[model samples]
Target: MNITTIGFDADDTLWHNERFYVLTQERFADLLADYTDRASLDARLQAAERRNIGHYGYGIKGFVLSMIETAVDVTDARVPAAVIRRILEIGQEMLRHPIELLPDAHKTVAAMAASRHRLVLITKGDLLDQERKLAESGLWEYFDAVEIVSEKSAAVYRRIFNRHGDGPERAMMVGNSMKSDVLPAIEAGAWAVHVPFELVWALESAPAPTGHERYRVLDGLGGLKALVDWIG
Candidate 1:
């Protein structure tokens, strides 16, 4: 476990994120309740989100667009313009929301930085929005480097580790998403730690690594110090 560098995912990994999205989705469901049931509306929104990922990628803007699309689809293009405006307002509110760091997120990252770990933030989303969140989170100074990618894949992890640190074998990734954070890092030959969030995006959800030698799941960020110590 000779890890020389560590990568972190943004969004739910370091700060409160999914909860806001869930709240917005609940509002969206209510707005469309006249057209369909909550479950059906949710399903349709998810389908729209999935369909729009390639076009919009992942972020609040994409989400708003998907919600509007879902609203129109469900209502047979009869959704009011005011309702569409409300959906846009929802996305704007999310963009303006305060950054709330997860429990021990700052302390853990600070500790790791103090311990001389080369910390890198590897996140995927709209660059401007991710940049805004990073700046607002106040955890920016701790990271030696920051990567705002359109997506996370094994090749991307491998390239990042190779360029920023020693190599994949000596690198680790920590995040909540098994799909974007852990699996890709593991596939790139790096160690990964899963810090599960209470609410995860459906697109980012995946089964946990069961018996992988280089994978570990922590209940929360507070356990990161112990894991790093054990690795050392």
Candidate 2:
């Protein structure tokens, strides 16, 4: 069966997203070493997610802001104002960093474009951040449509499919998050391909399906071409 349209999840799907977060988180840990333990800092930041969900929305920039808030709350030291400034600078750097598409992301997307398949990018994050990443990544041109959603759920996928897909059988979702990318897409009646990443966040965990015809898991985006070949 030929895939009429293909959907992709941003973040860890096509590029090195969380690794940048990891790098900055390490710096944050080291900066707060005097006032708090690394685990403690992480816990506080996690707590801030609940607090800021309504205010800042979601994405890396918001997360870095939460880290700053957490730091200020924990330390209560004006001396660390400089540290806060540095953290903000890091966030800016993260946003501006050039696109680092995963090994075969560009090639795969180009190939798919050549095949005349409708390529849509379905990512959930801060609207500005999502747009900026796509614009800078040289990938925006490859997609026919781009959906920046608030969360990755069955309902969200269904809505996107209804709007853009060729029913369930002909549209496929490819991404790195099992919870978001695979399960929800499969549940929405679209085929799913999981490109496993090394670091899977706790918030993004859902049970793996037992035996689903529409589900697949792979090592990385580099394997996507093979999957396309197999499917085609």
Candidate 3:
């Protein structure tokens, strides 16, 4: 069947998202190096994920705030005012850094758009941050629609599918996160492609059915051309 609509997950799927977070996080850890080790700092950040998922929802910004909370809670050593200023600076830096899309993302997305496929960007994150990134990346124009959701659940996918009024079989989802991009789309009866990044966070679950024929894990975004061509 010819593909009619394509749904894409932003962040690590098309761009270098997690790496920026990782960089800023390491810097944050450096500021607290005297009070906390790298391993311990990572644990504290992980703990914050567990704690804040219920309260703050998801995304890098939320994770950054969690790091701040972790710093405030774990360090018995009197954190100087300078250290707090450093943490806030790191957060501001994260906000200002422009989004860097993965290799071939622009070409592939443009290629699909040229082929008359309705390209929709479905991302979950802080609404304002996600919007800023999309606006800055110059990718917003390529999509027919853009959704910034709180979480990637079955209901979210279902809602997008319902809005399209097209059958799920004709829709395709591409992304790096297995939990957020692949499994949920598959459960919704849509085809999914996985272009994994170098690092997958512990908070995001891994893809379980690695060998499923309907699911694909590409070496990189360049391979997307062949996949989309075949689907066409």
Candidate 4:
């Protein structure tokens, strides 16, 4: 089947998302500086994030909670209230940070939209935060659909593509994460395109589907529209 629907992942894929977390993590390291060194602190925080994701899901809130958990752990529950306050403030700063669209993000989505393909924003994060980002992004109108999911799996991809387009066979999932966006979408029988961002979070990291025919990688989103045309 010809690809008629395209799934775009938000966060680092469309705009500057991971960079915020990178900055906030730096702050987290600072907040816990007296408790542990940077290397150890980073490892602990990553461990915390991995554990908390199942409970808190994903987004600024969960990230903040993970930071708090890490802080408490490294300090053996002796973490000062002031340090916790600063952590909360850090999260608020992130939530209020302005969305900066990645290079070619707008043009590529517009081109794909104009070409008459159904463009769906498929992302997993806090619902209100994701909605807020989309509203401020100014690319909202270009999307034929928007899915704010708690997670992305083969079943979710199949259901989304089938509902929003023809089916997984006629859809393409485009994003930066190999784990969340690529592997599962391909497993669901859709084309999966990996467009790398500068910074990939540890949790989102996965081995590329190296030899899969359905998998494709672009240097960036600039080449995406042409590739979609070629695929069609």
Candidate 5:
């Protein structure tokens, strides 16, 4: 009940994210339909994403590269330049995609800030893209600090919470990804709140810690303020 620092994940947590990737993926499948079936193409793309996460990290840039890799693999490196260009365009479109805040995202963040809790954005993705989204969200002023990490892990959570707040013991991480946001934060001894987002990305998926003392789940961001107050 002594939580002070509240950390939030940007994508899908504050706004719509995975939908763009999924839509682009559908587009990728369409482009590769001549060379491979949807199942084969999806599997190849997912494998490419998983393998390339370390090399490319998380973002549309990496996703575009994975699509290109999948295209090349499916077509034996014979995918036309036009298709490649279109894939690049899709990535740009995603990058340019406007920020559309989730239900109650704005109000919840405002309320949290009003309560004088130190809110921080702790998310993973391309630096520029994350920054752009945060800027567009118009909620940037609420956060006392922001962290766009290349990856999320227990150590990363520990370091971020320690630097931004009173350490992980008094920090709370809130996000849709159990893998990236909830689990690691809890492992770092921080309270973690899971707010499930639609179209959960494969890499961010993990089993929920249903009974962890510091773990809580909300059906939506609207419940966040009350949850924090109740915790206090």
Candidate 6:
């Protein structure tokens, strides 16, 4: 492993993110408890999320819209106006929630930056929301470049590698989602380190990589510094 540049995924990888979504979903379920059961509401909301990903993309805004859509569908379009108002409130609350860094995220990132590795943040979501989180996290200064993309794919990784990095062989992506961060970086010819988060969005879940030369998995960010040191 001769990695020179390292890219990080911003959401659950670097901070507590999906937990807020889960919390809001629970609130959403409670708000519409009369319309359906928890299991049924969860399924319908997931369905709505999948359907709206193309139109709204991923973020609190999209999640809020999905909740509203699910509410309308489950209630046969009779969802109370107050419920809709509450749903909007949920979205606003999520947007306003404080950015909580995951355990060792700050230390590990600082170590990587101190080691002179070129660091880039590659995350996908609403631009304003993502920017706000980055600003609040106070880790923005560590990154040499920040990319808020519509989606994470091989092409996207390739472009980032070409522009900010020496190329795939010299680049590594560290993140939580195998589907978004690890796999695509590998597909783009870069090394990838998977740092699994306890709660992952169903949309971002995928099978772990096995026996891949450029792929490695660590229990958490605690191992990130040593891994990058070894790679360097």
Off by over 4 Å in 5: none
Local distance difference test scores for all models: 0.93, 0.83, 0.81, 0.94, 0.92, 0.92
List model 2 lDDT by residue over 79-188, tens digit each.
36788888888888887878788888898898887788888899877898889889888988889899988778788877777777676667899998888889988988
Per-residue alpha-carbon lDDT of candidate 3 for residues 98-155, written as tens digits (9 for 90 to 100): 8887888889888888888888899987888889988888788889889888888767
Candidate 5 lDDT at 26 equals: 87
Model 4, span 1-232: residue lDDT tens: 6899999999998999998898888888887877799999999999998998999999999999999998999999999999999999999998998899999999999999999999999999999999999999999999999999999999999999999999999999999999999999999999999999889998989999999989999998999988988888
RMSD of each: 0.9, 2.0, 1.7, 0.7, 0.8, 0.9
TM-score of 6: 0.98
Looking at model 5, report the run of 10 residues with the lowest lDDT sum: 197-206
Q: Model 6: how far is 17 from its true place, Å?
A: 0.5
Runs in model 2 deviating more than 4 A are: 76-79
Per-candidate TM-scores read: 0.98, 0.90, 0.93, 0.98, 0.98, 0.98
- Candidate 2 TM-score, true structure as reference: 0.90
Highest lDDT: give the candidate number: 4
Error of 1 at 227 (Å): 1.2
The reply for model 1, stretches above 4 Å from the true place, is none
lDDT of 5 at 22: 84
Mind giving the per-residue lDDT tens digits that candidate 5 earns over 40-147?
Answer: 888889999999999999999999999999899999989999999999999999999999999999999999999999999998989999999999999999999999
Off by over 4 Å in 3: none
Query: 4-59 in candidate 1: lDDT tens per residue?
Result: 89999999999989999999989988888788999899899899999999999989
Mind giving the per-residue lDDT tens digits that candidate 6 earns over 49-164?
A: 99999999989899899999999999999999999999999899899999999999999899999988899999999999999999999999999999999999999999998899
